[model samples]
Target: MPQIAIGMPVFNNQETLARSIDSVLQQTYGDFVLIISDDGSTDGTWAICEYYARVDSRVLIFRQEANLRYMNFKFVLDQSQTEFFCWLAGDDYYSCFFLEKCISVLNHDASVVCSVPKCQFTAPAGNLSLAEGTFPIVQDEIDMRVTQYLYCPSDNTRMYGLFRSEVLRDSFPPRGFHAYDWALSAQTLCFGKHQEIDEVLIYREKTKRALYTGAVLRDERGLLKQLFPVFRMSVWLLRQKKFPRRRGVVRALIWLNLVKHMEYVSNVHPDFYERSRFFYTYLKKRL
Candidate 1:
């Protein structure tokens, strides 16, 4: 059995799937298995997956009857019986040393359940690099990490971190919605410390197909739908024993982020400012 299992859930990613697979195949750490689940892609994504599987014995490919979104990732995660696991997107690729460094961290530190590397973004315009700031190592204070993950304004980069398979399996599965990754990150904190490595190992490609489209305030109806998950997440957090004991603080933070998110959406997509109406207020008050 491999020491690490990388679950790649893909959907209609034919255009850039090859590069993603190549990045994984060329990893400096070779003791890993790559499981790719094509979520019923109508494109040539499955063909590419098949070719790579034939060439590399480590590559295992599966095809879903329909698109299951986050559940497809669950399918891949369930198949992994390794010490460490990672969820890789079909369009995203990682540096060759990503697994090497991440696996080393987990190997050395038994308390750390996950290791998140710095993220770099590539787009048609240019490249953007995000520094991994001083994120908390919450081995002792798990609640601290949980609160920060719930409220802090961070990218979904942490979601792709190398995770202890047992701890990851114990955490809640991601919701089948827009901000599911955010919720997953929060849930992971309840397991153990989330250690951050300063090196930029992951390369994320920016495109319309990406989940969060700039503040997510495309319109009143759209923004409301996107933000509804926050309420669900708040309830989910409150139910978890490892979450902050102060339920009121959690509730306040959730609403505060909702308002800030709406403002950000309005600023980026100004046309929605007039259309958003009193929907956000209703959501905040209602939730």
Candidate 2:
């Protein structure tokens, strides 16, 4: 069995599936299993996976019988989990040393649970831009680390980083909700430290998404759903029993940020602003 496992769950990603696989297979740290789960892709994604598996014994491929829309991410991880594990999105590719650098962090530091790399996102236009910051690596207090995570507007893409397999599984949520990745990271942070490597390793492909498409995955819809959401997040975190109660001051900061977010929304969507004001007024009256 390999010390590391790479789970690639893909569906109709023929345009980038081979690129993603090749990058992982060509990693400097070569002793790992590449598990590909095909979610009934009508495109050439399965053919690509098959070709790679034939060419490289380390590549293991599994295909679904039909287009089941199964939870492919967790499915691949369920197949096997070695000492370390990571999910490589079918559309994203990494630098050759990406694995070597990430595994090195895990190897040297027993205290660190996940080793995330700096990422550069690729726009559909083919332009590349480096992500501004990542989830911080606070070595000591869990609450403090979480505060840093909340305070800093960091990319949640760090969830794709390499992690201790057991820790990852243990941190997995019983059920997922909106902003669940934030919940996952906070839960994992409680267990041990997370280190973000300085090196730029992964090139994440950004999907073109339409605004207000009624997608459940989207965090925002309009003023009704978006109103004072950050403040609510603060309340939930402070009240939660799993972690220590964060400082009350956290809510105030969240409130301030909420104001800024509200302003941005108001400028971009005037109708949303009008609706939010009336809605908030109604709630205030009831209170």
Candidate 3:
């Protein structure tokens, strides 16, 4: 088996799929398998993946007859047999040393679930710009802060991070969550801590078709749909007997979600004020 497996789930990303695949093919660390799952793309995504598969033995491709979203993404990762696992989106590409540096962290520390290297953000029409790096959290403080900051009423983390294969297997993402990254990060923290590297190894593309493109706060119904799965995850963590710190983080996330719902009421969903008020009051008492 390859030392590392890079999994990507593609859906209608034909325009940028080739570039994303090339980015993985160009990785400095050559002993890795690029696993691409074409989730029933009607566009040229499958053809592009096929072309790359024929040319490179390292590239593995699969196709589905129907579209599957975040839940199917977990399936792709589950299929990986590599010692280390990372994911690249169909619309995003990574720097040459991304896998090399991330794998180095796992090599150095067997306990570390993942290492997040410095990230660069790029707009479709503009050049790449440096983005912030997360600080290492031996305890759960930094993890809590990251959760709060990313899911804040007005802020969201622009960059994405990688994860270890075992970590992914241990803490699968909650089904049907629109903000799957939030749950993934929470699970990573629960399994093992993360370290941050200063090397800029991932380039996040700010494309219009990307998931978080439109106004999040303005979409009240959509926001509520996203929050339910997160709320369920928090409840699941609270029932666990493992880490007390995780329970605390779950409480914090509950309040954050309540506050976010309240913020939505304050701005766009005034008619739902009573419902939001009830949720806040109930959660406030529980916390």
Candidate 4:
């Protein structure tokens, strides 16, 4: 079997699908499988995946009946049979040395569960800027990593890093609601610390932030659940028994982060935070 497994989940991403596939196929470390799952894409995405599978022996492809959203991510990762694993969004592309560098980190340190590189955000209009790195997650202390990760605003690019396949499988919990990615991330911290590479090598396309659109929630059912999302997400994360000893500490941290999250969101996304911007307004007046 190959040393690494890469899952690429695509849904109506025909425009950027080939670019992502090409980036993977161009990796300097080529001993890996690129698993592509078409999540009921109506566009030419399936055709693109099929085309790559035919041309590259390393590429494997599958198609889903419906838009499974985050489940599509799980589906691709489930089919993996490799020591190292990572997920590459259909809209994103990585540097040729990405896999090589990440694998080196994991090989050199058994304690590191994942190796994440700094990501460079790109827009359709060609604007580009490097995302900040140095997440407090590198610490071996589980509570420190989990609390810092939960409290701070991340670029949401760490999940795209190379993970030890066993830890990757264990980190993922059963899907429960919107922002399930955030929950999985917190859970990953429970297992081990993640190493972040300082180089800006990952090129992630900016996904839309429109709340009601398919951008935030996949199925319409998630709309109601998004109300009070911070607590809902925390409740889901706290249910896991991964860190039973740290539950009390984690609980306090969650509450603190929840308030901070509300304030952060209201300031960063005031329009989506509602016209009242209650969190921003109320906190400002009180402070």
Error of 3 at 211 (Å): 6.5
TM of each candidate vs. truth: 0.82, 0.79, 0.78, 0.85
> Model 2: C-alpha RMSD to truth?
5.0
lDDT digits (tens) for residues 149-243 of candidate 3: 43442212222455677767776655544355555565566666677787777776654432342334322255454444345445554454442
lDDT scores for all predictions? 0.76, 0.73, 0.67, 0.77
lDDT of 4 by residue, 188-254 (tens): 8788878888887689987644433343334325434333455565676667778534664565455
Kindly give the stretch of ten consecutive residues in candidate 3 with the minimal lDDT sum: 150-159
lDDT of 1 by residue, 1-287 (tens): 99999999999999989999999999999999999999999989999999999999999999999768678978899899998999889989999999999989888888888887887878767867563432555647666666666556355577788999987777655455445566677777777888888878988875543334442433224545554435545566567666666664565556646765675566556688558748877887864
Candidate 1: residue pairs that collide:
none
Candidates ranked by lDDT: 4, 1, 2, 3
Error of 4 at 136 (Å): 5.1
Candidate 3 regions exceeding 4 Å error are 125-133, 140-160, 207-229, 239-247, 270-287
Highest TM-score against the true fold, candidate: 4
Per-residue lDDT value at 169 in model 2:
76
